[model samples]
Target: MTAGPRRRGPARTVLVALPLAVFATVGVLAPILAPADPTANDLAASLLPPSAEHLLGTDQLGRDQLSRIIHGARISLAVTAAVLAISVTVGVVAGTTAGYAGGFVDRIVSRVIDMAVSLPGMLVALAVIGVRGPGVENLVIAMSLWAWAPYARIARARVTGLRASPHLDALRLLGAGPVRIICRHLLPPALAPCLVYASTDVGAIVLGVATLSFLGLGIPPPQAEWGQMLVEGRPHLASAWWLAYPPGLAITAVVFASNLLGERLAVGDERPSILRWVLPGRLRVRGGRALAARVTGVPATIATTSAGDGTLLRVRNLSVAYPRGSEHRRVVADVSYDVPRGKILAIVGESGSGKTTSALASFGLLDPSAVVTGSAMWEAGAAARQLVGLTPRERRQINGRRVGVVFQDSLAALNPLRSVGAHVDEAVRNAGNPGQRTAIRRVSEDLLHLAGLPDPATVTRQFPHQLSGGMRQRVQIAIAIAGEPELLVADEPTSALDVTVQARLLDLLARLRDELGMAMIIVSHDLAVVTRLADNVAVMYAGRIVESGPLDAVIGNPDHPYTRGLLDAVPRPGTVPGTRFRTMPGRTGAGPDDTTGCAFAPRCPDVVPECAHQQPRLLALTSLPAHRSACPRQQSDGPALAAETARDPDGV
Candidate 1:
């Protein structure tokens, strides 16, 4: 179910392509390759066995069996290809249109597809073929009528799911039309599964055509069709086995090959070659180790640092960068924060603000392509461990067991194929508790209940897709808490839900935090959510923290201009109907290649000339202890920073 690219090896390629190549060659060259006229009769050579002169011998009336089989491939392949083209084309177009343009059109199309699929496909094909008498053209038309129903169903389902995808919304915002969105975004990924289905359908279609011909309702006698040939050789089964065997073997081989090819292509098993088994386990391990090291680098081990008082997790001088040609592009720069035990620290920022990057780096979750330089020290009892320097194996020991993460989209984070119980069970196993396997169900139910799921039993049995957005999120929380983690990271957990659901989920998280007494970090762009949940808040711009303090100190009296602009931008109930919403003057200054100056200088409303020359260090405020802002012009407070009482002063 992952959308990641599949790797195909040479063995798999050969497995899929070689059979197809043989069939295609035979079909294309039937006329040129036949040795003798398939319809030519010779009473003397009738019922002959396979011989060098006639090769697969002669059928009744002296027709060359080899010639007939070769020509038969042409008939079967051509008809099947035509039927598939028509069916797939009609299905894809109808399904895509209906799915993209929902409501009336979708309902109408869904009903029609349901009706068509409900009626037996073979029965419908038989009825049509019976009404239109034998002939290859009529036969193809009969099969295509129901063939399209399956394709339409598949296409509709795929498109319906993709319509809700965040990527499609991004495309719409970029001004892409419906046609472009369908072709560029929807069709490409959907086509893969459809292609797999179509491949498997080939063998079935071939068999159906052959069955019709054998019944004397398809390609007539002397035409040299495989099914007709089978009928002719039936009476001479004992005396002349060659007449039936050749065509039967031909049909069997082609169908078998088609099915095998489809299976290999669908699964994308890269190590299909037997040579893999021949290699020694030690050599294979060495090779894999070398490859992993080359790609991801060996995990560095940093010595433990002294822990600060009451700080459960402390991050210092954190910077994350990715390789760009010979140099590196920093995404997060010199970020620092500390999470006190049993408290919430919210990192609030705009989209490109590097809040999420810094959080991910603290947990060692970022990819190896990113070079993270920092000291993320976590206090465990009397000892402290440097998370940034731990090996992947070492990190795994604490990740699910001591630290848990809830991602933005619950649907994307949870496996669609797995039941909620299975997800929780895996988490329990990972925790490595004694007798966990035996008590998995009980433990999972308890976790679900703790996460506030109404019917734990029902939810445990249901898959992620079956649940609503809020329910899926609750299930995700259950999974995260199954390990009884000490530190929980909720990364925009309620962003996708409606206001009512968001509030409920936030309340649930707050309750969990208080009950478990776990240290938590909330990464978000929504200031309302942050103020409601976080005790301390850090405002990030570009890749660095511009302000940090208690939520009340920061929101009640914002020091940085960027933070003030953000507060003003929030829509309030008292704003005049015709007035425009307040917005920052310019966009974020973060980019792959940027100048060495204050990142918010380009957008700052009261930008001083000195702002563009150098970046300011985070300095403490005289008014509030532990309150800091990265601004040189602290004496000049803009009008926008003035308190507005009419706004929803109660935090979101």
Candidate 2:
């Protein structure tokens, strides 16, 4: 179920670059394109206006203005190219090294760049020309001397900001050398902003060259430069306007085009709606109501049935698609599962398997770009609420109050600036807890204590950064449970943590579940982690629930090949040292909409010819009524998934 056509780059970018491209082309082909020799003098043909032979007319020196302007473009392009080449290379290399090295090197480079930027660039060029004597080489060198500073500044800032990122640490752990890390990872990203800046610098460099030539400090006389032509035609403005205007207009077009191209590149996808006129529907969000109306593609009259007896949250035929260009691409499809009361249901899968996506979609936690469809029945007494299409106000009533979510990255999840107490206090207040400031703080500490944090009173006062990764995660859990939520949804809660921390967190979750009787949906990639707490396990592959049943039953005897592969990948208690982990044999990035048939067919060990041609249906096994497998070959006497859809006539 894909939507509109694939999107392309911004239309305004093309419009902006058109003039620049034309100028570049003229510069490159000036010799062939010019009608006559620009420097060849003929006083008889001089002062000629628009005519059959001379399109842009001639100068006072009898030089063809068109040819002169074209040749002038060649000169301007040369200067710009030289300056950018030298400036970008020098600036980026120096700045990247300084930022990566940091300390004294960073301070020295930063101070030097500041000094260069502070000086007037035009004045620096003029001074250089005065000292070194004027020429094309001198002009490029002068401009580049001052021009390199801004790029250095941009690159330095970009690289400095990335120094503390976790990915760099990951690279170090992977044994990547400094040279490999900097060249392969750091330089590319640092260069992007520098290049964008250079797009803008094109105009300045071209203008500077013309300015110098105008003052007789640029290209020598008789070189047919735009500024030289303008100065020569100054006395003949009323008589031969063609001489000045042609070059003047060319310079204006180049400057305008370069500046515009730079802005568009910097803005990227956030550019204004210039293309909406050309391509109707804009294909973005047509309207909030319009997009919302089409979200589920189901009639509003069709309501969800009550959840099963012991089910806290029952999701059926859940699907989520994100907007790809104008079209929608489905990630999760027909994912069905249940979270029984007071029990942990772990959704297990490799990366991109849509395990987290399906869980997030069930609670309306997916971003606005997501188009979700399905029936997620959240049981409340005798009645049930459909979580799929709930309005913001309605979802808010349930999500933060009834369901608490803990994301994997605690640093990202918690505001670094705020104290842990502030975070939990806000959550308590948001959950409609009415209390004085003191009472709120006390309750916040109590929530932290309940989450198993040590010395909640002291922990509450510390910021997220001051705490350990495990502590920060517990803080998130504290905030989540501050609302006294019935269902806790944790996405990769123990990922990237030490074994001790992971086990402790898992134990805490299990304790909370057993003591408080909390129904939980835990999303994890490791089946070993799931084994610790999960009563039921749903194995996802390519956005579909390939197999799901009681954790013991499914883990002991996996019905689907994908499920078997996942279980096999789990680290066993006693394996030979240095033995490679047994992993599934195919790429895992395909979505449900990528193919018509089973997405895992290329990787499936028991793949039959039919697996490539037909969409497999999830069927129950004759051995277990509660269990189901998407693979049709599995021994089972069960009804078709179509039957389940048929039962819910107008459902997901």
Summarize candidate 2's per-residue lDDT along 192-242 as a digit string, tens digits. Answer: 778888888999888989899999999998898988888999999987778
Which regions of candidate 1 fall more than 4 Å away from where they truly are? 1-309, 436-438, 573-576, 591-595, 635-652
Q: What is the overall TM-score of model 2 with all chains considered together?
A: 0.53
Candidate no. 1 TM-score: 0.53
Clashing pairs in 2: 3-328, 4-327
Ten residues in a row with the worst lDDT in model 1? 283-292
lDDT of 1 at 156: 88
On the 0 to 100 scale, the lDDT of residue 137 in model 2 is 89
TM-score of each: 0.53, 0.53
